[model samples]
Target chain A: MKPEEHQRRFENTDTLINEPIMAVDITRYCDWLAIMFYYGAAHLVDKHYAMRKRPFHPDNHSQRVDESRRLKRGNVVYKEFLLLYNAGLNARYEPIFYDQEDVKELKESYDAIKSILLTA
Target chain B: MESTLALSQSYKGLIADSILNILPYTLAKDQSNLLETPWGRHMGDGSYYTYNLLESVRQSIVDIPWWTIGESNNMSQDTCETELLDRLINGLLAFATTEKVIISQREESIAFWVVSSALDIMTQKKYCYFFADIVDKEFDTEYIFDFRIVSPSNRDLKRIPTDAQVYVRR
Candidate 1:
């Protein structure tokens, strides 16, 4: 996808993240929150590598974030991205691993990542 | 400059012991067959082997998927192995430090996933270094663990008490 398309998706996902918690337990969807934030950052970062004729598409969570790390070496986003990625994985796989407090910390990381990647 | 001195086998062993002692669960029960050979996955027309650590049955812990080693030059393999190991250690340590507690005790025995990569193959050196101190166990998901990354040299490793239980995963 073009950088503009990626930016659009990143902005859309940000809107979803900002949606207020209602009767539907937002805490239960904490995993999705982290996952969504990660993909938002992933797409934004993908703009850099997507220019290649044969662009790399990651197969798994690690591969996805690892690609971002490889492309943006020495960037704070790599560290924050891994934290969010791991949070999503742990929440999905590890039985009862999701803690609201932990996700809150990761949300801070997501904001930091967005400030870095989403800016012009 | 920080010493890039290679860690000896004994140091790795002790580090592994420390992790096992503090953490409630193990990676796998005697994963002898796991690391016997490198795993091969069909990347494109040909097979490619990676020194990648994988998740185990215990969730996100390291498990080597033993498959036939594919053709790759020794020089490239060595370089790849070194780079992968360094990345894993740095990433894991970063994750550990970010969270207040390294390992949390779950009501259902949720295992903490830790990955270790061998430094030297010729010397049969296995396991990566990590520090673990079990702080609390009574409450659910409230265990506090103190983890520190030691340099390649053994001099920096804080001595765990001899009486501290050491569980060796080999």
Candidate 2:
């Protein structure tokens, strides 16, 4: 809830999405993919909330992404958030393996949002 | 200012593309009215509209299981799309009107799934909407899709009928 705590969590998630995600390969790593994707997204949202000095609540993630986009009133970032949110949902809920092509798509979405986050 | 406007347009286009991606195309019977291929997953062998784009979405949400851990056969890339088309036809019978409805899907998860009641619209020659699920999160809050989505070119909007009217259900 503290601002420093939120900052640490944000750094931690930024590392989670970037570093740990690279460990996943074409063979079998979907469970981690889905969890980290959702966490990465949720933490980005938490970063938004933390900027406003609000505690993070971990529910209705789609709502959070949309709301945060509205909060910042940014354009390209909204689509990035949408990609992350939707991709996260697919990764989390589905019981399928994310192939090379899938990871490529995830990487595109991940890169878009992560770049925006790092600069922010 | 120009950069801001361009990004705004880009966001809206992506929004529309996402909406169009998960949707089914109403088969214009006899193939007399339209071209065959808008690309494989966009329109099918001229008979079926490309409903299952790379196995991420389905023609009928009825086939999409409520639980994530269902059987694996449907998840395969090679899963026959005709199976999804068949489910849509069977599912259409529940409605009184025959208008076949479809949704757009470019993303991994679409919160809004529009089911057309399109047969009745075409047959009776009218626009109609029902049960905009606003209050209940357990159900659908998908807004009544304007004719913009169903018209010929998803981008051009050249042939959309002018007499569209919404008949909101009580």
Candidate 3:
């Protein structure tokens, strides 16, 4: 598959994986999801830039860095995929609160990233 | 002079609003007037008094609204990344060349690195400016403002500073 096509497939898969983690009563799962979402997004950007041989827009890059820092400082930045990296470390795991508002925020973040990818 | 005053005033409001939106709560009572520039008069309590004066005229023209809008294209994640990489490469290439390539990829790369490094330090310092929460008390609570006014003549990304102004409670 072409690079763009490959990226789209990965995005679709990532979104699917992210869906269950955002549901209510899955708070414990959120830390993991947030980590995955961040790294996945970063990797996506990295791959795109490496293939295209261009630097990311400053605004987008700044935003990514910001998000990355948020996860890291929250004490959840981790390597393992399943474990709540920061949450596990801090022992602040709470029951998931997957409501329409939370879901909407997730969707918005996903949509923004997707839109940037599609257009770039 | 009147226009400049108005523009400056408008920008101050924009900056304050932007901060409020991103910050967890309202700015502290003392730090509320942090946006006032030296040229603008400080009217105690976060308000400003404006005076219009025409300085030596160099050149002036009213902005015209262009009706033409560019067509939208569907971009993919990779494409966006590629675009960013290309810009970086271009800037780098400019830096490597003589005769002023005018793009300065090297400078752009350097700036990016600087900002990234600063961000790392800030993170270590527990100073959250962009995505920091208000509840966590570690570093002195201060609002750092950094924005660029991009114009056609100065499109080079390197010139824009990452940490514009670090504001503390006055």
Candidate 4:
């Protein structure tokens, strides 16, 4: 996908991060929130890579992460992207729910990734 | 045929030796009678459920050092174990060299041990599979490890192995 398309997808779901606490059960939404944060971060990574003249489109999450680790700003991307991937995996597969605190921590990672990749 | 047989023997020896090393750890963790667990049933009938090679590959992990996952909120033991296992696998895979690494499954729990005949047998490799019915059967079930990423999709066995060379200390 084009960098613009990837960025648009990220921004589209990025809006869900602010879903009204009163409207829905935050606990139930924890999984959704984590996944949104993970993919949001993922899209940012994809966008940054896409902007390269020789685009890097990793076919899978692991590939995306492994390839991103070799990027110029690999250290930040590697750590934050991995944390998001694991958090999203746990939320979706394991019976674990992201408490508000866990979600908040994940959001910090997302923001860090956004600040770095969005600027790049 | 002789070469194939030799290769098979070598693989079993590697697996059995690896299990023997981690057996004490599992026992120390009070993971006895692992054959009694539901996962034990999945492992196989208790035909070879002893300290011997065929019987010793039952328990996947033992003595997990549990730490709090989230602050002020203690996660359940299951969650804690799962998280730690995830970390351990990820760490091992990330740092692992593409050597002859073995992945063993004990019921639902899984462990990875990087074994090389070139290394001293006494130089421990910290990976285990306990409660074995048949070494061949269990080996058939095991996945070859490198440092493949665990994604939701693309779970093909062939593509799973990544270049792993982790030296996890005891």
Fraction of reference contacts reproduced per prediction? 0.00, 0.00, 0.00, 0.00
Model 3 segments more than 4 A misplaced: A1-16, A19-27, A53-103, B1-166
lDDT of 4 by residue, B116-166 (tens): 222111111111111111111222222221222232232243442232112
**Model 2, span A1-120: residue lDDT tens:** 554565577677657656644554543565466456556655665666666645555456655654544334334455445544544544443333455555555556556666776567
Candidate order by TM-score, decreasing, is 4, 1, 2, 3
Instruction: Residues A37-58, candidate 3: write the lDDT tens digits.
Output: 4445555554454454444332
Docking class of 4: incorrect
Those runs of model 4 whose alpha carbons end farther than 4 Å from true positions after fitting are A22-28, B1-170
- Backbone clash pairs for candidate 1 read none
DockQ for every model comes to: 0.01, 0.01, 0.02, 0.03
Q: Considering every candidate listed, which one attains the maximal TM-score?
A: 4
- Global CA lDDT of candidate 3, please? 0.32
Rate residue A29 of model 3 by lDDT: 57
Tens-place lDDT per residue, model 1, A1-120, is 776777788788777877785112456676677677667777777765565587765555545554554443324655566556555544454433444655576677778767766553
Provide the TM-score, chain A, model 3: 0.43
Instruction: Compute the interface RMSD for candidate 4.
Output: 14.4
TM-score of each: 0.43, 0.39, 0.27, 0.48
lDDT, residue B96, model 1: 24
The predicted structure with the larger TM-score, 1 or 4, is 4
DockQ preference between candidates 3 and 4, better one? 4
lDDT of candidate 3 at residue B133, scale 0 to 100: 31
Interface RMSD of each: 16.6, 14.1, 16.0, 14.4
Candidate achieving the largest lDDT = 4
Give the DockQ-based CAPRI class for model 1.
incorrect
